[model samples]
Target: MNALFFVMGCVDGRLVLTLEETADMLGMALQTAYNQIDAGTFPIPLRKNGRKWVADARDIAEYLDLMRKEAREAHDALKRKLAA
Candidate 1:
C-alpha cells in the first residue's frame, strides 16, 4: 500500500518539516501544534534542533494511518454494541 503526505512546499530530498509547515499541513494553529508536541499528544515525535522543532512527513503520515485504524475499530465496536 502507498502512504499519502499532505504537506507541500517540500523538495524531493529530505522529508523533514518545520513546525509551521506541520501546523499548516495539520490544519491547526502553530501554537496548537507546539502545545501538542510539548504535551506529548501530537501524532508523531518531534526533534528539537537548538531552538526549533522539526517533524518527519513520513512519520506524520504513518501516525495518521494509525489513528484512522484506531478510529475505525472504535466505530465498529460501537456499532456492534448498538446493534446488540
Candidate 2:
C-alpha cells in the first residue's frame, strides 16, 4: 500500500494506528514489527495503548517523507558523481 495513502487515510480524524496497521505501512511482517518493537528498532516511535502498541499517523508520514527525501538526494548525488 502507498504510505501516503495509508497516512492520509488516518489523518482524516484518526490520529493513531494499531500495531498491524503500522506493520503494513512499514512493509514488514507483523511478527517482524513486534520483534522490532521489542528490540527498540521500530522506525516510528510507538506507545503502549492498554495492551496494544499504537503509533502516531503523523510520525509515520513524516518518517516516510524523510526517507523518500534522503533516497532522492542520494540518487541525485550518485548521478552527479557518475556524470563528473
Candidate 3:
C-alpha cells in the first residue's frame, strides 16, 4: 500500500510519464500501452510532444490499483459462491 501511495504521489502535482517509461513500469509492450490508451481503458496522455505520449503517473497508478482491487474482489466473491 505504501508502494502504491508512493507511485501515486511521485509527481508532486502533474502525473507525468513517457510512453516507454510507462510500458517498462507496467511490464507491457510499448504498443500495447498505446493500444490500451487508444481504447480508453488507460488514462489518456495529457500531451503528445513529437513522438511521445505523456500520461499522469498518479492517475495510471491509481487506475491500476482500482482495477486490481476490483479483480480481487470479484475473484473472492466467486470463491465464496463456489464454496457455499
Q: Pick the candidate with the highest lDDT.
A: 2
Candidate 2 segments whose C-alpha is farther than 4 A from its true place: 1-6, 10-13
Q: For each candidate, how many residue pairs have backbone atoms clashing (under 3 Å)?
A: 0, 0, 2
TM-score of each: 0.68, 0.84, 0.65
> On TM-score, who's better, 1 or 2?
2
Please tell me which model should have the higher TM-score, number 2 or number 3.
2
- lDDT (Cα atoms) of all candidates against the true structure: 0.74, 0.84, 0.70
User: Can you write out model 2's per-residue Cα lDDT over 1-84, one digit (the tens) per residue?
Assistant: 235576867557577888898888778999999898889888999999999999988788888888888999999999999999
lDDT of 1 by residue, 33-77 (tens): 878877889766789877999888787667667777989999999
Best candidate according to TM-score: 2
Instruction: Give per-residue CA lDDT, model 3, range 18-83, as digits (tens).
Output: 777667667788898878888887553456868777766765676678768889999999999999
For candidate 3, the 10 contiguous residues with the lowest summed lDDT are 1-10
Per-model RMSD to reference: 3.1, 3.2, 3.6
User: Candidate 2, 35: how far from true, in Å?
Assistant: 1.0
